[model samples]
Target: MSSATVTTHTDDWVRHLLFDRGFLASMKGESIKVYLTMLTACGGEPDRSVTISLRSIQDATNLSCPTVIDSLNRLEELGLVVPTMRKSGRVKTYYIPGVPPEN
Candidate 1:
């Protein structure tokens, strides 16, 4: 058996941001889903980042691989999320520009 202490603050602003088209908001279906999912995976900080896997995302949102990738790419282009490689060089660390990263 395995357990994880997930410290994500994903839903705090959902209600407020439901119609907020200025805060990295996306009008596209897949893009919105991806953005919401990323928020859900972030730490409780207002603009925190988290480590998300493609497989986990696919399971959580039921989005296809291509769609997920495309959505992430779109988000990146929009400067909403910043992706950096960890020391392991495998998993990526995604940071939201609105929040300062942990030191």
Candidate 2:
């Protein structure tokens, strides 16, 4: 077998859910990238309340801390990822649950 990691074929799915369904297409470029990256990282778990750390996302995406934080904030503003307060003395955690329909 090949030593490469078998990534999930999620591009079409993301396109369908975010674009074809008219959710994220209206978002900016950075916002779209971060949102799609989070969705891809989240996998098939249906728990919308699932939480993750910025460091984890930065490591996964190979992005800097500030970049990850900025993108995450944009997603939050767009009603994509939900932010939660972590008990780590004001450190925050974010959950990339799917967004609601953009009425």
At residue 59, candidate 2 shows an lDDT of 65
In terms of lDDT, the poorest run of 10 residues in model 2 is 44-53
lDDT of 1 at 65: 86
Per-residue accuracy of model 2 over 1-103 as CA lDDT, tens digit each: 6698655545555555677777665676666666656665667432345456667677677777888778877777766778766756434655655435646
- Stretches of candidate 2 off by over 4 Å are 1-13, 21-23, 26-30, 45-47, 89-92
TM-scores for all candidates: the values are 0.65, 0.61
Tell me the tens digit of each residue's lDDT in model 1 across 7-103.
4344435443444535444447888888777877874344676887887778888999898888888888776678875536336678865532222
Q: How does candidate 2 fare on TM-score?
A: 0.61
Residue-pair clashes per candidate, as listed? 0, 0
Instruction: Tell me, by TM-score, which candidate is best.
Output: 1
For candidate 1, the C-alpha RMSD (Å) to the true structure equals 8.9
Off by over 4 Å in 1: 1-26, 86-90, 99-103
User: Which residue pairs in model 2 clash with each other?
Assistant: none
